[model samples]
Target: MFGGPYPWSLYCGQWSILPPAPKGNYLKDKVVVITGATSGVGLEASKQFADASPEQLIFAVRSVEAGEKLLGQIRKAHPNLQDKVMYLDLTDLQNIKDFSEAIKVFGRVDILINNAGINPNFDEGPYKSTKDGYERVFQTNVLSPFLTTLLLLPLLRKSSDPKVIFTGSDVHHIAPSDLIETALQNGQSIISAYNDEGKYHNPTRYYESKLLLQILSRNLIKTLPDITTINVNPGLAMTNLGRDFNLSLSPSGIVGILWFVANARSASKAARNLTSAAA
Candidate 1:
């Protein structure tokens, strides 16, 4: 093996000897929901979750079409996993409510992964408001997951050792103020707010989202004693989540090679973390 990345030990071709899947049957018997499931990290996590016989895997995506497409492909690849896609445009309040309602039919949720995000559009990235008028990243990355988690809390409680996992990042260490200001819309720049740009710093949006998420998870952990909450960065995931996520931080090509080299863990690692969270 390679020496591995700077921050995380995870890397390509590395094997995790974490015992066989789990006592549960293929994760299909358990209820697992992953937001942003249409692509990127969410998709990878979903694919891994499919390996276990969980009772249900709910793929929450803003686009019904994309959700359906992902479902088709996942189904074709893993016929045993009967995952259903639902419309959850987190920026839209009603959409979030509807998503919660639709999942009500499932009755219980054993695992929940809050992992959707959006980089601000370059032209007016930072200063833009979502359809619900909240800051885009805050609404999509933070609020959406926050609200979705709330709606599913009851269902989570019904199960034993119900788990909630939030995807975190190292970027949160910088620009904590921008994250708070963006949440309040205190004249945050469109680019800086969306991409985490700064007169001295650049590409803060992804980091800021993670900061808020870390804080949110810490605080929420206090309130829910029964529900276990854990946040993981998963090293450098290869999803379209960061680095050029907004107008800034767009490092040129060879990202796969670099990411694979630098603490770059596959979506399977993140998904594996989720599996541990469930246990």
Candidate 2:
């Protein structure tokens, strides 16, 4: 079910259509922090986690208003849930540090789900760089998350069973290794290669970024021996990650169609895997 014809076999199979998260207070007394919780799998994962009844569920989001709205909806459904939304702009390094510092009030975070990501349509124009001078995709998808995880290591270690979940992708396997090798051979860092506008490619940039994220997460485990750091592919789910793609005869639009087709699961259903990982 997991491996076969590209996305179709995975989409048609049972992996995409997951059962609802089992009802229980498995997360009782635990504190969970999730990024990108206002939409996509992160939004659904928040709801599912609420059902499991954690002591506190904090959502690290860029938009406090949107996070609050989602928190209200979840609270309305599960009145007993204790949740709050905090601002986290992945594009800015200082912002991520400030967000981590604010999280110190919670004392410890049992599970950290790095679920927020972006896949910009490179066809739109030249790649943009973050204020930190890194490519937007690389910053948002790889660097930011890595930095956040590092900053939160102290708080995470306080948990008896601390775990970090990185939302990875199957597409990572197809990342442009030629560029990566060429960059490394020239003494250019991966970040440098990504920032080079001359080498950026549509869609594949996202794929390559995911690959880098996966690699980083694996290495992170060595630094965090006690913490259960994992990277999980939520499979292809319809999410705002493809918000930039518009349907048309254009290359990006065609990729968007494939994205829609491959994403056989709803965000809610796909989130089961994430919540399950926390369990």
Every candidate's lDDT: 0.68, 0.84
lDDT string for model 2 (1-279, tens) is 112235444445435446568678999999999999999999989988998889999999999999999988998888978888999999999999899899999999999999999987535456789898998989999999999999999999899999999998877776668777987899887777888888877657787888899999999988788999989878777778777754476675666576556555777777888887888
Q: Whose TM-score is greatest here?
A: 2
Model 2's TM-score against the true structure: 0.90
Q: TM-scores, in order shown?
A: 0.75, 0.90
RMSD of each: 5.9, 3.2
Off by over 4 Å in 2: 1-20, 122-124, 249-259
lDDT of 1 by residue, 1-279 (tens): 112222333322234343333444545468888888877767766766776767788888878898888888878877877678887887898888888888889889988988777654223333546777666666787878888889888899998769898877655665346445654677654434443333212235445677778888999899998998888665455566544433333453354345445655566565565555555
State how far residue 108 of model 2 sits from its true place (Å): 0.9
Angstrom error of the Cα, residue 197, model 1: value is 14
